[model samples]
Target chain A: MNDTSTRAPATRRGKGLLPLALGMVLGALAMLVGLAEAGRLKPREPQTVVALGQLLDAEHRRVDLMLERGDMAGAIEALEALREQPWPDHEAGGDVGMQLRHDVYGRLLRLRLDHPEVLPVEPQALLRIAEEGLGESYRELDINPFTARLAALRGEVLEQLDRDDDALAAYVEALDMNSALLDRELAEEGAK
Target chain B: MGAGALLGLSACTAKAPLTAPAGGVDESAAGGDRDDASLRAADLSSLELELDRSWEELRTLEDSREPASVEAGAAGPGDVVDRCERIRGLADRICVLSDRVCALADEHPGEERYTSACGRGRDTCTQATEAADRCAAG
Candidate 1:
C-alpha cells in the first residue's frame, strides 16, 4: 500500500508533460506563420516601377514633339536617351516594365522607318530589333491575332531590306492566320 | 498567470495582418471610382478615333507613299511637319489628361482637389478634339 501511493504522483507528472510539449510545439508554429505573413504583406517599393513607366511615356512625348518641330537630330538624341533608360526586368504586376521596353523599341523602329536619316543604326538593324521585340511579345502572350499585325509589320521591314521573297512569305502567313488582321484598324476605329 | 499568458498569446495570433499588396498603381489609384473609370475610358476612346482620322488624312496627303523606301517625297517638308505638330498636340493632351486623372484618384472624392483635376481633364480633351478636327480638314 505504501509503494502504490508513492507511484501515483509520478504517474500524474508523466501525464502532465504531454500537454506542455504539445502547447510549446503549437506556439512555435503560430509564431513562424505570423512572421511569414508579415513578410508577405510588406509593401512594394514605391517610385521604382510605376514612376519609371511614367518617365518613359513622358520621354516618348518629348521625342514626338521634337519630330514635329522638324528637329531630327534632337529626336534622335531623345531616342538614344530612351534606349539608355534602365527598364526593370520584372515587376509583380503583370511584367509592365518589360512590355513598356518593347513599346519603346517599337517607337524607335517606326521613327527610323519613317526617316532613315534620323537613325543612328542601319535600317536593317532597327528592323531586326523590331522583329525580336514583336516575336517575344507574341510568344509571351500567345495572342494569335496580334501576331498577324506584327507579321505584316515584319513584311514591310523585310521589303525594306530588299528581301522580296521573304516579305511575300510573311504576308502570306499573316493572311493565312487571319484575314481580319488587315481590318484590325477598322475594328478599333469602329469601336470608337 | 500561465493560463492568462496563454490566453493573451492566442488572442494575438487570432488576428492576421491585412493582405492588400501596396504601392502599385491599381484601378483604385488610377481612376478612383467605377463612374470615373468608365468616363475616362470613353474620353480615351474618342481621342483614339480622332488620332486615326488624322493619320488617315496625313497618309492621303502623302500620295499613299510607304514609310519605307521614301525620303520626304510624300509631301513638302513643311506640310509634313505641320501634320506632325497637330498629332503631337493631341498626344500631349492625352498625357496631361491621364496624369491629372491619376493624381486626382489619389485624393478622396469629397475633396475639392478631385473636382478641379477632373475639370481640367475635360477642358483639355475638348480643346484637343477641336484641334484634331481642324488638322484633318486641312
Candidate 2:
C-alpha cells in the first residue's frame, strides 16, 4: 500500500511538470518569433524637409507670376494648395510647414487687399491666419522677404481703395520696418 | 470560475459593443454642432469687417482733396485732373463694395452691426461717387 501511494503521488507530479514545461517552451518560442519579426521590419524613412522647402519656393514663385498676370483667382488657388498640404507635426520639424503656410496666407491677404473685388471673400480670414501662425516671429526670422513685401503691397492696395490716410499710415509703417531690415542686413554684412 | 470573474468578463465584453454605438452617436452630434457654430461666427465677423472697411474708405475719399501745399504752379491742371479721375475710380469701387456688403447683410439677418454698417457704407459711397464725378467734370 505504501509503494502504491508513492507511485500515485509521483504520477500526479509528473503531469503537473509536463504542462509547466510545455508552457515555458511555448512562451520562449513566441518571444523568439517576435524578436525576429522586429529585426526584419524596415526603419521609417525620415521626411524630406528640403523637398518640402523646394515645393514651397516653387509655389511662391507661381503665386508671384499669377499676381503679376492679374490672375487673382489663380494666385488664390495656388495659395490654397500650399495651405492645405498635410504638413508633418512640429515635433517632426513642421516649423517649415507653418512658415510656408504663413507666407502663403500673407500673400493671399495682400492680394485680396489689392483686388478686393475679385477675391469674393473678406481679407480678415487670411490676415487672422497669418497673424496667428507667424506672429512677431515673422519680423524676427525675416527668412521670407515676402512678409515685408506683402506689407508694402498691402499699403498699395489700401491706397488703391482710396483710404489715403490709412494707406499713408501703412506706408510709413512699412518704410520704418524696411529701414530696420536694411540695418540688420548691413550689420550682418559687417559681421561677415 | 468564481461569480466575480464571470461578472468581470461579461462587463468587459458588453463594454465593447454597448459603448461604441453610444460614443459614435454622441461624437457625431457634437462635431456637427461645433462646425456649424464656427462657420456662422466666421461668416458674421468677416461680413461686419468688410462693411466697416468700405464705409471707412468712402469717408476718406469724400474728405480727401488736393493738399493745401499744392499751389497752381506746383501741380498743373493735368495733375488736378488726374487726381480727380483717380478719386472717381475709387468712388466707383466703393459703391460696388457697398452693394455687396448690403446683399451679404440681408442674407444674415441677425447680424445687426453688419446690416447697419452696410446701410451707412452704401450711403457714403453714393455721396462720394457723386462728389468725385462733379470734381472730375469740373
Candidate 3:
C-alpha cells in the first residue's frame, strides 16, 4: 500500500465490449449470407415469360424459313429439336409457355400429317404426342388459336388411327375455340 | 315444222311470269329482327362443323398453294394477307358462334357453363382480334 506507483486503477474499460463487437459482426455476416442464398444480392434474371415468348416467335420464323426453302424435312427436324428441349413446367412457364408448347407441337404434327414420309410417326404415337401436348388443364384456359390448332391436329391424328368418335370430339373442341376467337375478333373490329 | 306453227306452240307452252310471294316486304322486315334472334339461337354443333370444314379448307389451300412471297424467316406478306383472308372467314364463323354463346350466357345468367363459355369467347375474341389486326397490318 505504501509502494510508489504512477499506474491508473484497472477500470476494465473494454471488458464486455469484445463479445458485443464479435456478435454484431457475426450477425451482419449471417444476414449477407442469407441474402446471397436467396439470390437477392445477385443481378436479376431476364423476364422469363417475355424472353420465352420471343424465343417462340424466333423459332417460328426459323421454321418458316425452312419451309420457304421447300425443305419440309428440315422444318420437321427443327420442330422436333425444339420439342427435345427442356420446356419450363406450368410453374416456371405458366400459360404462355404452355401455349407456345402447343404451337410447336401443332406445327410439327401438321407437318407430319401433310408429309407422312418425312419423320414418319405412327398413328398411335402421334395421338400420344397430341394428348401430351394438350395436357390436362389446357381446356381451362381461354381459347388460344395455337391450342385450337393443336386440338385439330389431334383430331387429324385420331382419324389416322380410325378413332372417328374421338376425332370428332377433338374437331368439335377446336372448332368451338376458333369460333369463339372469331367472334371476339369481329366484336373488336366493329368497336374499332 | 312451220315457223309460225312452232312459235304458236312454244308460246302456248311458255311458262307463266314469276311473281313475288305476297307479304315479301314484310317477310324480310320480320326476318331482319329474326336475324339477331336466330344468330343467338344458332346451332353451335352445326357451326362447329362448318368451322372444321373451314379449317380444312384453309389448311388445304395453305399447303397446296405456293407461297406467293417468300420472306427470309417467315411467311410472306402475301401469305400473311392470304392467311388473314382465311382467318377472317374463320373469324366470321367464330363471331357468329360467339354471339350465340354470349347471348345464351346473357339469357342464363345463373348457368356457370354458359357464363364460362361466354367469358372464354370474349377473351378469345380479344386475342384473336389483336392477332388479326397484326395480320392486317402486315
Candidate 4:
C-alpha cells in the first residue's frame, strides 16, 4: 500500500510537470505576441524633420515671391496648398516649423487683404484653420518675428473689416512689437 | 497535489472560455461609437476656407482703383474736388468691404475654423478699414 501511494504521488508530479511546462511556453508566447501587438517590438521609424523643414522653407520662399509680385491670389492658392500638407511632427522641430507655417499663412492672408485687387477674398476663414493647427505652438515657441508679422497682417485684415478703433489698436500693437523687436536686434548687435 | 493541479487547469480553461466572448462584446461596443475628432476637423477646414475667400475679395477691392478715373485724373479733365470725390468713393467701397469681412469674422467667432485661423479677422478687418478711411480722408 505504501509503495502504491508513493508511486501515485510520483505519477501526479510527472503529470503536473507537463502542464507546467506547457503553461510556461504558452505564457512566453503570449508575452511576445502582446509586445508585438503593442508595437513595442517594432523598430521606430525615423522622422524627417530636417527634410520637412527644408520643404517648408522652400514653400515659404515661393509664397514670398508670389507676394512680392503682388500675386495675392497665387500666394493664397499656394499657401492653401501648403496648409493641406501634413504638418511635421511637433517633436521633430519643437513647434518652430508649425509657428513658421502659421505665420507664413497669416502673412499670405494679410497680403491678400493688402492687395485685394488680386485675391478678391479675405481668406480669414482659411487662416483660422491654419491658426488652429498652429495652436499653442504659436504662443509657446520663440516666434516673435513671425507673430509680429502675423499681428501686422491681422491688423490689416481688421482695417479691411472697418473696425477702425480695433484696427488702429491692432496696428499700434504690431508696430510696438515690431519696434521692440528691432530694438532687441540692435541691442544684440551692440552686445556683439 | 494532483487534485490541486487539476483544479487550477480547470479554472484557467473555464476563464479562457469566458474571455473570448467578453472580448468580442467589448470590441463591438467600441466599434459602434462615433469618431468626433474627424468630424470636427472636417467642419473646421471647410469653414476656414470660406472665411479666407471672403477676406481675400475685400483686400483686392481695396488695392485697385477705377482705371477710367485714373486716366481722367491724368488727363486733368475733372475739377480737383470732383476727382477727390471719386477717390473718396473708391475708398468708401474699400471700407464697406472691410466692414463686411469684419461682420463675417464676428459671425463666426470661436468656431473651430475661425479660432484656428487666428481668431483676429475682426481685428484685421477693423485695421484695414481704418487705413482705408485714412486714405479716403486724404
**Candidate of highest DockQ:** 3
Clashing pairs in 2: none
Chain B TM-score (model 1 vs. true structure): 0.32
Question: On residues A1-192, what C-alpha lDDT tens digit does candidate 2 reach at each position?
Answer: 011221222232233455333332332222223222434111121133333544654565465456556577887777766666765333332333334444556556655664567746644454444444454444443332334444544545554555544544444444444334333433543576
Clashing pairs in 1: none
iRMS (Å) per candidate: 29.3, 32.7, 43.0, 31.3
TM-scores for every candidate against the unseen true structure: 0.37, 0.33, 0.49, 0.38
Best by lDDT: 3
lDDT of 3 at A65: 74
Supply fnat for every model shown. Answer: 0.00, 0.00, 0.07, 0.00
Rank ordering of all candidates by DockQ, starting from the highest: 3, 1, 4, 2
Tens-digit lDDT track for model 3 on A1-192?
Answer: 011132112222221444333322332222223323434222132134334544655566677677788788888888888877776665455554566577678777877887899878788988877888888868865565667778877877876786655655665577687766656545655686
Report the lDDT tens digits of candidate 4 across residue range B14-106.
Answer: 222112122223212334232535323332333233223322222222122222333233322111233233234333433443444344456
Taking all chains together, the TM-score of candidate 4 against the true structure is: 0.38
For each candidate, the DockQ is 0.02, 0.01, 0.03, 0.01
- Model 1: residues with Cα > 4 Å off, grouped in runs: A1-49, A89-99, A135-137, A142-151, A169-192, B1-138
- Chain A of candidate 4: what's the TM-score? 0.56
Going through the candidates in order, state the TM-score of chain A alone for each one: 0.52, 0.49, 0.71, 0.56
The 10 consecutive residues of candidate 2 chain B with the worst lDDT sum are: B1-10
TM-score, model 3 to reference: 0.49
Worst ten in a row by lDDT for model 2 chain A:
A1-10
Best-matching candidate per TM-score: 3
